[model samples]
Target: MLPYKNPELPVEDRVTDLLDRMTLPEKAALICHSRMTAGPIGDLPGDLFPSSEELISERGITHFAMMAVPDPVTMATWNNHVQDLAAATRLGIPVTLSSDPRHGWASNPATAHSGGGFSAGPEPIGLAATDDPDLVREFAAMASAELRAVGIRVAFHPMADLATEPRWARISGTFGEDADRAVRMIEAYIAGMQGGTGIGPDSVACMVKHFPGNGPQAGGEDPHFAYGRDAVYPGGMFEHHLRPFDAALAAGSAQVMTCYSIARGIGVREVGASFNRELLTGLLRGRFGFDGVVCTDFNVVTGMEIPGVVSLPPRDWGVEDLDDVAKTALVLNAGADQLGGESDPGLVLAAVSSGAVPAERIDEAVRRILRDKFRLGLFENPYVDVDAAAKLVGASRGRELGRRVQARSLVGLKSAAAPVAPARIYVENIDPVIAAGYGEIVSAPEDADLALVRLKAPYDKREGLLESAFHAGSLEFPAEEIDRLRTIAERVPLAVEVYLDRPAVLTPIAEFATVLAGGFGADDDLALDVLTGRAVPPGVLPFDLPRSQRAVEESRADVPFDTADPLYRCGHRCPRA
Candidate 1:
């Protein structure tokens, strides 16, 4: 066996053996992280891109991020087939499969996918609301096991970025707005995902994301769009944002994904964190000493056009004018190890051929990437057991734990003196069948003894398919909806629960709600269980509940707890009845 394929050799020696043998094209392919859709053994869907076999053979690509969540048996079979393709390659480098967080309820195609066959739980914000590091660690450990079952070796999760900006669309993925709490949670998360001893056969490498922090978006807009490209630090809390990442590194996180926003007023160049040399190299590598794989946020090298719905521009940010090859060169020069969401290895090859990017830089990136694959034990056995995957993917224990956590993460904003078990209950945005389990499901509030209302935190509808997925814009409910809610509250006592994807201006809802609760990626059954007092919610506010839209606008996006007269402060929780 070759030194690189030897399981007993040191990881460094294995990496060196592989790096020395790799060609320029192979090296370029190793650094370009692309996406793949799951399908049957020989027939894989590409949506709009090339097939998995074509990418492996023609492009020489070995790294892929999975976009969909199929059943365990199918996923495992697909993964094994892909590994077989990689094995047939010139170097036979094992394919490393990565995925966005697939255990959560928040289903944004651009960010996180829904828990299809995995244990379904609350979003990261729900975990933050619970304020328990042990629980976070447990969740990560469970998730790691499930991921490894289907051959997914990397987790693009434990989003260490703080939800400092209440209006930010990606807040659901973060650990609230506090630096200290986020640091603690992140440390525990990394420890759990990496199985405490660090990346190994049983471990799923954690790619703690949006380095230097992605939460302080200007106007609370996401950096994914052109309008939301600027990540401004008005409160000068740039260093504060790095706290969780510092903790992640300390806890042995295996990878880091840079944000897409053009960071403004933080001393570095006004470009996306992935393209900025000072931020990626000087700060992340130099000051913090993070030597792990540094991957760019998806599609930083080129703009993507999603047919007729929307023409999404490339998030090159400050370097928008540069060609795809130049942008690829710039990202490598800035010290990133991989170009995520990019399929074309030609960009990397062209950059090297034109002498704009040095071959040594490509080698440096390949070494880090190879080292991680080796540490993950992918070199020894890349294929997962198809039969074992079905039995292990979503075990009963993990599902029960997820259900319990979903209930526990529900924050009680207002509580009744005792659990209200009304004979007749009216419901909205809640399953009537589930409501019937607690009490008689009524047609209207007037006919019922109590009314149960479930609401999603309000967001103005955007035009595109991808744009609409992000729940951005206003946080306030429409005036008509508020008036409708008020009418119901006047007729019958109202129990209101809002899914706090982003911090909503809940002052009006508070006035009418007899019992107000906040949820993060919870199901109707879980929400109703807490509402009817079958389950006890022990969560607190992860972030401040801003009083109004005006207050949210006035608050600094970069600073936590800056809102004037918030409805509830961070960590606020009502006493359990």
Candidate 2:
């Protein structure tokens, strides 16, 4: 047996043995984390990238980020097939599969996948609303087990970024704006996912992300687009944003993912976090002492274009003028171990050949990458039991816990005139069948005892295909929608529930609705349970609800709880009446 294949060998020894025998191409493949399609066993048509089989066999790629939310059985089978492909390679290096947050209701194809065949849980903000680190740990434990069942080893989440900017598109994914609370939640998350034994077979290594915080985007726009590339710190809260990452590193997080935004106003160069040596090597590695794998946010090396679906230029930010080879070299020299959402191994080879990138840097990155795979025990057994997957993934107990969490995470802002037991409920954006279980469903507000309305936090629609997925822009509801809501409230006593993906300007809704609440990610059933007297909403506001769009616009993006006279302060909750 090869020394690297020996189970009894030390992981470092195994990594060294493997590194010695690996060809330059194999090392290059290990450092590139690319996206892969998930569905049937065969490659689906209309795929813009190479197939999994082609990636592993031809390019020797081992790391993949799966975006699809297929059924557990199909996912397990596909994972097994991927393992089979990897096992046939010359070195038999097992594939490491990672995914964005998949146990939540939020389904942005660009960010998180839907909870298909997985236990449904509240978003990270909802977990923060609970303000229970133990419960956060419990959710993470459940998510970790489910992920491992379907052969996913890495979790691209527990986004430690503070939601300082209330209008940030990705606020729902964060643990809220409080640095101290975020620290507790992030530590618990890492402990739950990685487990007490650390990055072993039973663990799903947490890649605590958007390091140095991604929440302070200038004007609350995402860094995914050119217009939103700058992450400004006008409030001088740049160091404050690093608190959660400090806690994450202390908790033994296995990996870190950089943000796409170009950090400005700090001493570092105005470039994306992934290509900033002072941030990655100086701050994260040197000051914080985090030596784990640092993966860049997706598609930083090159732009992507899927015919008619999406067209995203490379999020190179300040370094867009650099060629692909130069970009690749800069990322490597910046101390990132992997290029996320990138598939071309030829670029790495080209960079090294042209002397733009040092061969020593490649070796160092390969060592870190190989070390993680070994620590994860993927080297010994990469394949999962197909039969166990169905039974283990999204089990009944897990789903029940999710439902309970969802109900508990609903934050009541106003409940003074909430209906205790209305006979007829007029519903909007709610399942009539689910409403029937609680009360008689009425079609019109005039005929009903009370109106139950569900709304999403306001966001102006963007035209770009990929850009639209991010819920950016204004927090105020449109004038027409507000007018319609006003009409309903006037007809009958109104109970309003808004999904707080981002903090909404709730002043208008609060003025009319007798009962108003905010939720992060809850199902119709769970929302109804809270609306009726069946469930008591114990959650508090994770972040402030701005009083108006003007206050939101006036507030500094880098500072938390900066909006003046917010409709509801952070941690505000209505007492049960």
Candidate 3:
């Protein structure tokens, strides 16, 4: 057997030998990670681009970011089949599987998959609300075990970008606005996911994201569309945003992903971080000393067009003038080891043939890729036991822990004079059976002693297909919704539970409700537990609740704790009974 295949050999020796044996096509395959949807073993969904056999056997692609798997056993079987395909190649290199966050209730296909067949609980923002590093560590550790049980080696998560801009659509995914608190959360997160030994088959390698920081989008616009492309640093607080990533690196995160936002007014060239050599190579790789795999966010090389529905031309933010080959060369030279969501490796081979990219640059990228796989022990054992997957994934103990964390992470803004176990209760968007356990369920608000209402944070409501999906635009509630809440409050004492996907203006609702609680992707049962004093609420505000929309507009996009006259300040919560 070759030295590269020998488990006993040093990791450096194995990586070096594998790099020498790899051809340009093979090397390109290692550096390109494609998107896949989970389904039956050896069979892929129709929506997925490029067939499974074509990518693995013909293109030599190995890394896959899987989404929408129905169950644990099927996911494990699919992984085994994908690995079997890679093993059939001439060199028999094993595949490394990755996944977006799938342990939460928020199921955005592009961002996070549904926690169906796995532990489902509050999102990361909820974890931040707890503000307990020990709890965050425990959550990540359990999540890591479940991910590895299903053959997922990489966790493309712990979105470390600070949620400074309250209107940004991705705020629900972050550790919140305070840099120091986010830094502590980052350390605990990496520790839990990687464990003490770090980056082994037993560990799930974490890809800490949006390097240099993705928060502070100008006017809270996302970088996904042309309208939301600018990231202005008016306060010159760019370094403050980098604190979480710095903390994550110190904790030994194995991978980092660059954001799509094109930065402006802060020193380096105003381009996408993925294409900016100074930011990716000089700042991150040079000053920060990040030698781990640096992957692009998604689809930087190819432009996407959905025809009348949603059209996103390529995300080559600074270099839109350049063609596809030039763009590919620029990304490689900028120090990106892998292209996320890109299926074709031939584009890279073409760039090398045109002399647009040096052959040595490919070697550097492939070396990092091979080293990560070797460190993960993928070559020794890539297949998972399909039967054991169901037993291990979302095991009873793990789910119970997730529930406890969910209960602990609920933040009560205002509590009623007494516990909310009224004789007659009217509930909206809550399980009727659960409410029955506390009081008699009634249909009319007038007859009920208390009215329980659940609502999502408000947004401006963009009309375009893709634009509307992202919760961008105004952060204030509409007049009609505000009126409705007022009417409900007038009829009966109200208990309002608002989902803090982003910081929202809640002055009107606060005025009416006898009790108000803020939740970040938390379940109704947890809210009930906190209200009835069955469990003590253990969460705090991860960010400030602006008094009004005017305050949010006045706050600088790049600065944290800048909002004035906040209704509820960061780290503030109603006292426990």
Query: What lDDT does model 2 reach?
Result: 0.89
**Number of the candidate with higher lDDT, 2 or 3:** 2
What TM-score would candidate 1 get against the native? 0.98
Q: Write the per-residue lDDT of candidate 2 for residues 356-403, one digit (tens) a residue.
A: 888999999999999999998898889888799999888899898888
Residue by residue across 479-504, what tens digits does model 1's lDDT show?
99999999998998888899999999
**What would you estimate as the lDDT of candidate 3?**
0.84
Ranking by TM-score: 2, 1, 3
Better of 2 and 3 by TM-score: 2
Clashes of 3: 1
Worst 10 residues of 3 by lDDT: 41-50
Q: Which stretches of candidate 2 lie over 4 Å from their true place?
A: none
Candidate 3 local lDDT, 1-577, one digit each (tens) = 8999999999999999988998889998888888766677555444435667888999898998885677898889888888889999999999888988888767665677766488866788888888889988998899888888888999898888999888899888898988888888888988898894368877888899988788999889888777777888899998888889888888899999989989899888888988889999999999999898999988888865434445556777878898887888889989899988787888899889999889999999998888889888899999999888899788898888888778767888877664446888888989998878878989999998888888888988887666677888787899998898798888988888888889988888888888788888767788876655456667888999999888889999999988898999999887663
Q: Score candidate 1 by lDDT.
A: 0.88
List clashing residue pairs in candidate 3: 303-314
**Model 1 steric clash pairs:** none
